[model samples]
Target: MSRNLDLDLIRTFVAVADSGSMTVAANLLHMTQGAVSQQVKRLEDVLDCLLFVRKTRKLELSREGEAFLVKARQLLRLNDEIWADMTGQPLRGALRVGVPYDLVTRLAPAMKAFAEAHPHVDISLVCAASPELSDAVDSGHVDVSLLEYVASEAAGEVVGIEPLVWVNGRGSDAWRKRPLPLSMVDEHCAFRQVVLGALADKGIAWRTVFESGNIEATAATVRAGLAITAWLASTVPVGVEMLTPEATGLPALPAFAICLRFPATVQPAAQEFARYARESMANEPGTRRAQLANIA
Candidate 1:
């Protein structure tokens, strides 16, 4: 006797594997937890194996579930590929993309050009911090993202890198002093670690006088001469001067990387958008200038 399995059951199974919780998977699939549980049970019955083990606060994957997840991801990917091929659509659909705030000024214009080139596609641009943006992409809330690549979770190809320079209000000499008072993003920021890490490595003293999570506020604090702070060269607000050792006597951070991430299941139009991002960023004058300035 042959048994037929439901595709919805398989989808629920994959969502549960990805989310690690029935409630979260239910939210993703827009189904109730009971429905999700029933589907998982149906899936298990068809496969005749236990899939997940519920612990105190989380669901742990059994060895069988672990193997099943790999297969589920492959099946979903194959299905998407097959569906896309069969339809032969131009990928005209709403695409939501997550980008870090700083890239608005640096890369938004190029993205606008991409949108103009593909007028049929509706695009939604969400500006967020790197970690938040990455989370959005990982959770399938956004099609693609541009974010920083820290030593932790350094998974994607390097898309852009620039020196993180100390910037201060024009004519401010605070950066020239030892144990600088700094303006910085709050604890949740990706660059907060980068800044603190670099200072700790050099054994430099710093006091965080301002901890606004907003980049604009951090830059404004620096511009008002309240504190000196590190900034990516491309996104540094105009009129604030980059601190050189001649001016600040502090060693410069030579390079920090930015990256683009998309699911292995990203759609064709999304891939087209990513290609545009890669190509436009490759020709970015700001990035080029920063690299040259760092060398010189």
Candidate 2:
């Protein structure tokens, strides 16, 4: 006999995987923590495998669980699309979304969900620096923009808050150099100015050894132990580990608001995209997704 995977169980698993804590996932899912734990257990039993390895502070995916996550996401996406098709009028249109290069991957879940739900809507993703994205939003070239901005400077709805963090290769001592070596994006990157200002205010000497528009290049430099880099905590790549400010003697960096921007007269498709993006990104740790009012 074949067993079908329960999407509810899979959703709970994905929520826990994203937040790393059942309590946070519970809050996001509006379920009790114990209930969330039970669902995970039930899923594991159904699969006849352990899905998570519980650490002292968080739940991590075992190798088997990690493999299942991708399939789980696909199943949910298809399910969501089918449900949307059955329940609502399919809106036909196109949407251009502006996103920072570092955030493109972060937008994947929202993008896929949105695309699946609105199959008739075409989406064009414009990857650029935050500042450029801001310009695109202002000029009306982009229908919606996800931005990284100083809290006080955010002109759009603040959807989430993400603290900046220092990251280097696992076990790399590159941060110990007197004049710290650095890998970063160019002036167009929104983080460049904020990160440099923090270091300067700390009276720390630093030098930029690598600078490019490619985020992967910067991540590779840090992963190779050639230099250290800073990024929003959630967007840090896999090979690098975030260094504790206290342990590394690095200055604490400021948090940036993840803002959503679009003109007041945007199309129904744009508004629809915003709603999906907001809901999808809400569960991320430190984000205030629950507090956002419905987009006007």
Clashes of each: 0, 0
By summed lDDT, which 10 consecutive residues of candidate 1 come out lowest?
149-158
lDDT of 1 by residue, 141-224 (tens): 888777765533443446777667778899887675567788877666667777777788878888887986577888888888
The parts of candidate 2 lying over 4 Å away from their true place are 1-89, 285-296
Residue 236 CA error for candidate 1 (Å)?
A: 2.2
The TM-score measured for candidate 1 stands at 0.65
lDDT of 2 at 5: 82
lDDT of 1: 0.73
Query: Tens digits of per-residue lDDT for model 2 on 1-296?
Result: 87688877887887776557788778667789999999999998988899889899878889998888778756765675566568777777889999888888878888999898789999999988988987676556788889898765654556777677788899899999969998986668888888888889888899988999898888889999999998877787788888877888888877778887763234567767877788766756443222111100
lDDT winner: 2
